[model samples]
Target chain A: MRRFFAAGLTLLLVCAATALAVHAADGTVYGKGVTLTESVPIADLMADPEAWVGKRVRVEGLVVDVCKKRGCWMELAGGENQPAVRIKVEDGVIVFPLEARGHEAVAEGVFTRIVLDDGLGEAHSHEGHDAESCRKETRPGVIYLIRGTGAIIR
Target chain B: MAGSAPRANHRVRRWLRVIHRDAGYLAVGLTLVYAVSGVAVNHVADWNPSRVIERVERPLDLGDVRTDDALVDAVGAALGIDTPPARTFRATADRLLLFWDGMTVEADLARGMATIETVRDRPVLRQVNLLHLNEPKGWWTLVADLYAVVLAFLALSGMFLLRGRQGLAGRGKWLVGAGLALPLIALLLLRGGP
Candidate 1:
């Protein structure tokens, strides 16, 4: 009886460990897990982004690109033909991994718009990418940026 | 009085040895962890210490796929995936990006070429790096602070560990001076740049 119980317990523990590993393989959170219950679609936010500016909102989309150097910012895919939005976080505060590029992410942040100087050609210096990299704009002069607080990528 | 002074000096040295031995043992594991992670992170410009990224390019004949959905379907089929992509982006007229968990596909619609990138964590090193970077910064900050204090105690206690030849009063002082001078010299030389 004792031997049978021991064998059954070992099998149960093994099964539990395997289940956890499988679950953990799917998701990773940076900074904090998203708290906003409702998330706005990227298309809606892009339609009239000025209305959403300064408002704390949550958005969910597939991560199309991430900052290769510092993991500081990530570009999330919007609608099929629409432009993606840049979710920028503080350096070293929340590093969105490069592998997270293909994963779905729910991110919460305040949306802010920045106007660029054409001559100086400053393209979101925090990203450390090429100057033309902040091309996720629907318009020519303005850029939509989210000061991200937290995110969950799965 | 002379004997007492020497005895007091001996007692202080004995205590230093005891504290140094205990702290040294306690610091060994964390010291090794920080030292290894420090070297790895120091050269982060060259490589990602926590994750390994692999890229492959293959000739993918996506055919005459016009719509975004059709393009994603074709790439998924080529990549041996049954599920639809998590997201798709039409980066340009010629370039399309398909994203999935742990994988990304960048395709050139005009050239029929696809570049796939996949990423995976580097196991124990990833966790160690996180600790060293203080990524988990709640209770860990306190722990790290305590470790710093222990290390300081070890360094100060260590200076008095020996007596004459190999001790701080002898060649040990030169060794310590050299250790400190190297970093100062490097800073003086390289501080103007990176």
Candidate 2:
């Protein structure tokens, strides 16, 4: 009975610690050069992507997804079920936190639109996918982008 | 026949013991690594067991060279990335994908904002889980299979380590029986009734 009780206690403690660790890992702050300031709603900017293209803009939205390969880009959740806007940053310069998923972020960058071509070997590397899957999914499409220079993962 | 050699059975048993002991010694380090990572990975719902990725915010000023090659060159120069990307994919009109050996970059053409996210290993845990996950495929798979065979040998030889009171014929019988039965009991209790 004593051994059984001890085992039960150990199990309970382990379960609690696991939960605590996960909570602790949940919070990610990508604070460096990116600072949140005077951003418009993502929906508003995306509405006139052509007008915003080649123009610097700031937008705020909840992050629905992030590139798992590199924190190079993130998709901001759209308002009213609109498609999320993809914000791209130069790899290694301004990396968004992968853990920043489900958090809100304010991004300052150029709002631009591009017609992607299949000349690319692989598809857009989005949310944790292997290269094969990405290659398969790689197809020509139009995308709205924020050339994000600074971003704050709130 | 070779199989009919006088003490062939005894010789074979001796060889098995030698092989088991040496293989067990060699596998001890890997076993410990996987054992620790296994516990951590089993509760993946509670946490991420592999891949420690980090991101940071930084600024860039692009001087209008603006051509695709020049952009890649300029960004590579800015980041001080010694090697050029293996492939660069234009994902969208403004977004560029730069693929490196193990690193990647997403660049936006409209604005010169660059976000660099990199994969970092979590000290020993990353390597541990790599082995546990059998990540290094090809030759490593064969090696892992050999290790599995060795472990089976260890368990089997362990039962015969002693004789009479401690050997498989005696107390070892009960211990081994329980060891094997425990898993079945767990499976039935956890999966059968439901």
Candidate 3:
């Protein structure tokens, strides 16, 4: 009976630790929490997003915008004239607070470029926003974003 | 021998009833949270379940605020907001955005308009929705999984709680079949099910 009590106590403590780890430090960790150490400048990534496609990279920048509907994505500010790079996560997997805009964030994810066909003639919807509202499209058709795995917003 | 078999069956049914009742009691709180949040989330396409957002537009005349610092100070003064914004971004030469906790300002430098949007958590609903959505993962995941198991057990045990015409072998079976068929029918109608 004493051994069983001890084991139960240990399991509870482990669970407590896991819960604390999700919101551990000064910053709130979302999803699995950013793991990559090296940083890639948002400017550089936006300038040549295609080269980084399919590769996991970490980016640090000011959170300029977030998905208001679902908290599924955030736009990180790039350089002076460069458009912000979007870090898109699967909805509900990670919820970026609408208030996270303006805070500094570090996110790790695989860079991706989604090519839209002209034949479809439909402007893609980025979760809630219609094509007219989606500002991240590379040109008239392609969308460039990071398929985010985790992030830390300070 | 027939009496013994019925007696044993009655004893098992009694035990099942006790278990089902206790489990139902145990599940009340979490069940309420999940049920309410589930309905709110299902209609997420129509509204935000966790936060309430309000937007207001105010006119402000900041005579030619050129630099970033000047713009922040001017906007702060006009809005009577003493606290500095967390960050500011220049979306365009004519547009500047200032952000604070639960609040955002979109300033039209060309037109002297400030659109202030404030977001607030929806009281008890927000807290329950967080648990329902599994936002506080880790330990909560285990809690949710355990709740799911408890719910399954309660459902199965409930079928055996009644006997005769009201039991699984009678009208209860038809009710259960209808309950199961609804989802399958929905799948066929909506997703062209396998």
Candidate 4:
């Protein structure tokens, strides 16, 4: 009887420990879809992003930020003077990890510039929760995006 | 009249029993799947419910590893795997990362240490958990809706299964009421909090 109780206690402890690990996002993500054939440095692409617009090209760079809510997109740093580009994946398809910041990543996608309106621009911000805040108006500057089909992060 | 009423009651009870039992039987497989995965997922901290992460460590003889290719080759040779990485990058002077589908290798150039980490789907758990997770879209969602209908049918059929002293009018009502109250009480307690 004592042995059975001890075994049960051990099993409970093991299960409890396992539960805790599932809560946090593990800093790991699998590569999605095709391994893109060619990659360009983020610095070079930022210089002539328009040239690569609508073209599928891979880019490797240091990841600066990731969406805290859903891992649907990330921002990768470019050259010192260049604006970091956002890499957006289709929702429920390929999810980027929230813990991918500071890691080097290679993404392959179409590079395009989007003109932001109050509705669309605020949809991409972190604090744009409510309908009012999500509709926060901003000047229509170019929002460079590398809408990625596949990615590898480390 | 008395005999006819008893016969009608008996017939209704028989049909209800058949429906409840059959529905319960059909739901057994899904119930077990949901229950097992549910328990595993609830803890969220102790283990990875979706994938089992397999880790292997090795020491690389980084003799002349200067370029990214050389570093990948060294790690690959250490692990004795032939496939080239999907992507490789040097994050810092001391660190290099090689990525493949479901796998990652980190090389510490300064320490000559290398580690390969891979994730594997956890057998039955992964498949069942997919339904539990609602990550699988499209037709599977429709199947889940069907399952919900079965559940509602079972719950309603069950309430009508018993009669007399052992029925909903007696001890059974108290049990069912407690079952309903528990979740409501928990919700109330949690409403003002996190």
RMSD of each: 6.9, 19.3, 4.1, 12.6
Q: Indicate which candidate wins on lDDT.
A: 3
Cα lDDT of all candidates, in order? 0.79, 0.64, 0.82, 0.68
**Model 2 per-residue lDDT tens digits across residues B8-39:** 76687688778778788888977897789889
lDDT of 3 by residue, A1-154 (tens): 7998899889989877866775556588898778888999888887787898999999988787887777888988754445778888987899888878888899999998777554333333452223123333333457678889999998
Higher DockQ: candidate 1 or 2? Answer: 1
Estimate the TM-score of every prediction: 0.71, 0.43, 0.86, 0.56
Q: Give me the candidate number with maximum TM-score.
A: 3
Candidate closer to the true structure by DockQ (higher is better), 2 or 3 = 3
Candidate ordering by DockQ (highest first): 3, 1, 4, 2
Q: Candidate 4 deviates by what RMSD?
A: 12.6
Tens-place lDDT per residue, model 1, B1-194, is 76999899899999999989978987998999899889888877678888787889888877676777887898889777798877677777888988777777889877888988887878877888888988755556777999999998888889998998989999999999999999999998885411
Task: Give lDDT for model 3.
Answer: 0.82
**Deviating ranges (above 4 Å) for candidate 2:** A1-154, B1-20, B26-51, B59-65, B73-87, B100-102, B109-112, B121-139, B169-174, B189-194
lDDT of model 3, residue A54: 93
For A1-154, candidate 2 gives per-residue lDDT tens digits of 7998899779767865764564356333232334555666776776776777787777776665565544567877544345467777775455555556556666777787655564543334431222211122345676677777766665
Clashing pairs in 3: none
TM-score between model 3 and native: 0.86
